[model samples]
Target: MEFRRLIRGRVDEPQLERIGREIAKRYDRESVRISVLEADNWLSTPCVVDEEWFVKVISPQNALVQALFTGARNLGVFSRGEEGFFERFEDPLAMSQHELEATRRVREIGLNAPEPIEAFGVDEFGVLVLEYLPEFRTLDELPSTEVEALASELFSALTLMHANNLAHGDLRGENVLVHGGELYFIDATNVRKDGLSTARAYDIACAIATLEPALGANCTVDLAAEHYDAATLLAARDFLDLVRLRPDHEFEATRLKGEIERRAD
Candidate 1:
């Protein structure tokens, strides 16, 4: 059970093409008309295609593919590979394998992620086809309540992963997407099966630190403290304070604290 095989079950190019064609038909889009939007430039940027889908390509034989598989599952992203594109990359086989595994795992967890449509390792390049989320905004731009709700959902998701011995290596506001008023976890490439407790705590801390500033007055320190551990609450408060001190930061800490205390009374 290699990681790649674990994530992506054995499937050849002809099968992948069939799958892709099926997906295209289902979506009422032409597979041949879909063009390549971008390629990896070592930035790990999520490639956007036709304003309708995102794509991630990989070489079939890469070891990192297994890791990606686990990540995609944890984050709930969809993934598949393209046939006859293996020769397009420096090591198409390895990359294809890695991306396929990642995509497969992401699709497994029932998260709102891109859907994989095809996968195949060939001489030109190993590539993945994924569904794209549209009208999505980053968490940073979302409303405070929406952000907090997303944080709650993300924490709950992490809790479930921790219970099953999984951890999202990188959990941050930037890694979350808000589409149609819902949160979607993206970028699970660094996910692993170790340090579940620590990773869960760290992710909680990251969410608290990241979202505290945008929280409304109704979202008080005490309310947050009620939901999180003492240490995490404190860290969140400290982070909030640091941001408050910055002239450019829009939040008013003194007013928020007073509002919280008033509500407590």
Candidate 2:
């Protein structure tokens, strides 16, 4: 296994080697493909080692990964480790086990989701092997009309997840993929198996909020109204407005709040 070593901390070379070996061994492939993906704000840039299955593996940035996933930040000095910066180092395998299970569950339920080929117990690799759909495009790349259509398609996936008592804690455009006129949901890191949880509302709100860039903030409200009842729409609007008010990005919150209030009237 060859490690590109584009960024030192990004890919765990040893783990990558092990993963590659395991993949080759399991599949009886003689040669393995390896490539590096640059890091981005949304996800830890993972290396694509197996082109055949599109294997994306993240080294255990453990607590840091968890914090980023949950949008939680703390002031602390950075300490280097295999997983990444961590206040207290956590085992990568232990941390990623739940996520792997959640992702597999999404597939088991027949949602248009990634097939979790290999998940937990991959030797501290924290690897999430997913079926690669190269044709899928993010919501940002789609036009307004397609964005609205994708929004409706997303609602169907959301319904399946919620009906099974699963809430994709992170509901953003980047997490939704569209291919061959079908919508597929990915990134199960934040899934919670509780339909009744407030997180479900958050998912709906986040979905609508994420579509605002392409669909327009006001337009998304109407789009969501097509599928959701009055109460749910109201709840989604409230949540979307609240997210806009976070300290760093509160400029739009007041306007959104006023809009929601006026709509209620």
Best by lDDT: 2
| lDDT agreement with native, every candidate | 0.49, 0.58
lDDT of 2 by residue, 1-265 (tens): 0222322246556666777787777779885776765433233445565655656565555435555534332121111111111122255554445555777778777877766666544665555666777666766568888887667777777777877767676566666778888877765543334324455566677776677667665766666667776676666555554455322122344444455556666
> In candidate 2, which residue pairs clash?
60-83, 61-83
TM-score of 2: 0.75
> TM-score for all predictions?
0.51, 0.75
RMSD of each: 12.5, 7.4
Ten-residue stretch with the least lDDT total in model 2: 76-85
lDDT of 1 by residue, 1-265 (tens): 3542444333344644554564467668887333333221221223454566675544343324434433443332111221111111235445445455544565576565556665554344455556688777877777776776666666666555555554444455556677886666654432344434444544454455456577755563544555556554443333345334322235556655454445444
Candidate 1 achieves a global lDDT of 0.49
Instruction: Indicate the residue-level lDDT of 159 in model 2.
Output: 74
Indicate which candidate wins on TM-score: 2
